[model samples]
Target: MLKLLSTTLLLSSFIYANNVSEKVEDFLDDKFMENPRLKSVDVTVSDVVPLKQLAGWNAYIVDVEAYLKAQPKRLIKQRMIWFSDGRIITKELTDMQGGESLTDLVKPPFKDEYYKKENLLFGNPDAKHKVAIFSDPLCPFCKGFVPGALDYMKKDPKKFAVYYYHFPLERLHPASVHLVKAAAAAELQGDKNVIEKLYHVQINPQERDVKKILKAFNKAVGTKLTPKDLNTPAVIKQVNRDLDIANAVMVGGTPTIYLDGKVDNTKKKYLKVQ
Candidate 1:
């Protein structure tokens, strides 16, 4: 009976892996054209390990190694999450508290030094919940998520303190570098709402004029910022620091949020305010 039980378990594991593999392939096939550079995408689900029970949902983070048949035909590594109820999260996950993950791997170490007082853009400095937002000024998702996060924190001032970091995706949003640098410069000048206003502004893709953006920045944040302000040594250094921290944690997208230094993979924890 013991032998039979072991065989059953092995078979179940195999079947589960097979299903996950198929799902990943289906996802890639459907989203093939999402990236213009991809002539073809070949993905392999190397492993599917069960993770902690996440808020009553059985969750697992899958390891995917993909080959992008682009101009140079490059290979890439990615981690994706899968839920027992057919839900999938394609973002990276990290645990800053030194806890063991589902795969028995420790999350990347997060330094508290990174969240200095001067670096904070919103919320009470002494608040218990320290949230950090790494975002791009021109990202559409950042527009929605950044404001949403701030609004959520406002509800409980005593419990939450948020930090802001600029991560401009220049390849995608050409005007982002200027906007981010301007935000850093505005911060230096004590313009507290510069980043928030930038997020709220409506940007037309065809007319990505720097002068127009500067005018809007001045109007929204009550500061007459010019192109020269964005080129200051201090502003450049601050932006570089943000980029370095982001790269260490393998952040590939905008609006990456960390609550108390850990990557909040279950975004429901941060987004849904109870």
Candidate 2:
């Protein structure tokens, strides 16, 4: 009788959680409707990551996809907070002592599976330190930092293993989506220097057409890859996987760095890693 009772409670809890998530999604949809610029909006909540419980509230990191009527071709991805006291939902929470946002305080930790061999951009896999970077090729800050980090890994290959993941800020750099896809395709074709070479490629950031991006990519990377090459199932899958991992890790911007499975806000922690 006790076993059956426990199972029933578990099921009820699961149902309650689902209901809360649905309500959060609806709230976001309604909120977006208030924007006059967005004629119509559809909000899809992809992941509701639970965080440490506050005094009587449950906190969640809500990953949202907002499809706006004004921009049918573009999908906006955003991360928001949801604090619930069972009946009421609030959007923001902060730590009073340190003034840290809940999102920063409870960001998910890196999983071991994230350190895939295919994502390794440089250095020995078994090196003493593992550095993972979520970067956008077109982001000026990434353009400045990534190459220098790669150089450090190259110089001391045994000291650090660097892995690169694509986190294209499509809204800011419309061209980066294609560039990242092209880089993935190049990697599939055994191009070792494609990632480094791509930073130097002079392509218009506002350009969105695939053909033009491919033309520039091929010329600069010295590869004759066509649009079909960049759109192959393998290349598409690789880019998607990288983006998914970036989302999972709550990477909001380019050049988000991780050292030994922890967020490195300064992004230069690897320099001191012995």
Candidate 3:
């Protein structure tokens, strides 16, 4: 608390000193990135600025309430608890920077009403249809049919929505999980065109470079993935989340399609579940 107050005072004086100088204001704005306390400070600046003058600063007020709220982490935001504080412990993803934060990436709060051009479609997020999918990338059957089921949007257009859930049968296909991760990474990259393609290409038993796999996987589905991106904490965490979701659902087989949001064990195909 003492440290925070001291730093706050220093920053305040800096801002106050620049109140009369345009050049000084520009210098501080450029130096804003160098503030070491930025990530730790729970602070906000609020003002309704005109579009034309939005870029100019020194007019906003410090939101003290917002600052007070920033002191404690949200429950969901409290994602790590390593060895009870020894290491960063995470349930959804271990290697990602904002693994939990990416919940909006895996499934957004407000989904599309019509067929989503950017996102996958199944049951109507708005209307009479609700759909679910049980899929594993290592399954040949899933690789062959799951994409077709998603393509139904071409025939039916709107009036329904779709949700995809991971179902990895570790017993039957031991390597399926990573393949699913690669696909999830692609899906996250907004290259739906190549996600399924990655699954299909990687199903083979041949071992190869992880980078090469990511590259080939991206190109096949009409997406481009850099080798650098594969190592990102976000992608790794997402892949781990897929594994967790699969374990939660206990899907025994691949391509176990569900329709209208119901998880029917006896029904495996889309229309069959319907």
Candidate 4:
């Protein structure tokens, strides 16, 4: 009887959370519709996880994607806080005694699969310290950070391992979609240095033409890969897998670094790895 009661409560909680997520989506849609600039809005509740309880309310970390009108290919992702007492709902929650925002305290823990051998870009796979980075080749910050991280691994190969994952901001750098795919294609062909090489290659961020993008990529990486090369099943699957991992981890932006499966917000924790 106790086990059955526990299972029933769990199901009830899940249904309630689902209802909350749907309500949040509807609220966003109605709010966005009021703006004349936005032709339409589609909001998706990606992940909802419980957070710490405050005074008399419970908090949840809600990750959402708002696809705006006229920008069908663009996604504006955001992390929001949902405070509820099973009767009232609010968006802000502050821990006065702790002196921290509730939202900042919540971070998605890394899954074991994130350390897959195939994703290792530098250093020994058995290194003592593991660094995972979700980066965009066209991102200005990633352009500087990714190479430096690679160099750090080179300096202490046994002490540090760097795993690279693609988190291209296609809305900002339209060329990155192709560039990341090209890099994946190159990796499939046994080119281990493709990630680092692509970071140094200069290309217009606004350029979206696939052929033009490949021309610059091939010239810089010394791989004469055609668009067809990037469209292969293996290459596509690899890129999609990277993207899925990024979304699962709630990677909001480029140059997101994780040290030993924990969020390294400063992105400089690898420098201290000895």
Writing each residue's lDDT as its tens digit, candidate 1 over 92-192 gives: 34455755344223334457878867677777888877888888877888886778778778677778888888888878886777777778898988877
Check candidate 2 and list the clashing pairs: none
Best by TM-score: 2
Runs of candidate 2 exceeding 4 Å displacement: 1-26, 29-54, 63-80
Segments of candidate 1 deviating more than 4 angstroms: 1-107, 205-208, 271-274
- Candidate 4 lDDT (Cα, 0 to 1): 0.80
Candidate 3: where are CA atoms >4 Å away? Answer: 1-123, 168-175, 199-203, 206-208, 265-269, 272-274
Candidate 4, residues 186-226, lDDT tens digits: the string is: 99999998988998667899998999999999989999899
Q: Which TM-score value belongs to model 4?
A: 0.77
lDDT of 2 at 110: 83
Superposition-based RMSD of candidate 2 using all C-alpha atoms, in angstroms: 4.2
Q: Worst lDDT window (10 residues) for model 4?
A: 52-61
What tens digits encode model 3's per-residue C-alpha lDDT throughout 1-274? 9999999998985664344233333333444435553332222322211112212222222221111234434211111101111122121322265333221122211223312333343334564565556676667777777776666643453554565666656567655544555666677766645544555564343434566556556556665666566557877776555444443333336665444544544444445423
Residue 153 Cα positional deviation in candidate 2, in Å, after optimal superposition: 2.2
**Candidate 4 Cα outliers beyond 4 Å, as residue runs:** 1-53, 61-83, 86-101
Q: Locate the minimum summed-lDDT window of 10 residues in model 2.
A: 44-53
Model 2, 4: alpha-carbon shift in Å? 17
lDDT of each: 0.68, 0.82, 0.46, 0.80
Better of 2 and 3 by TM-score: 2
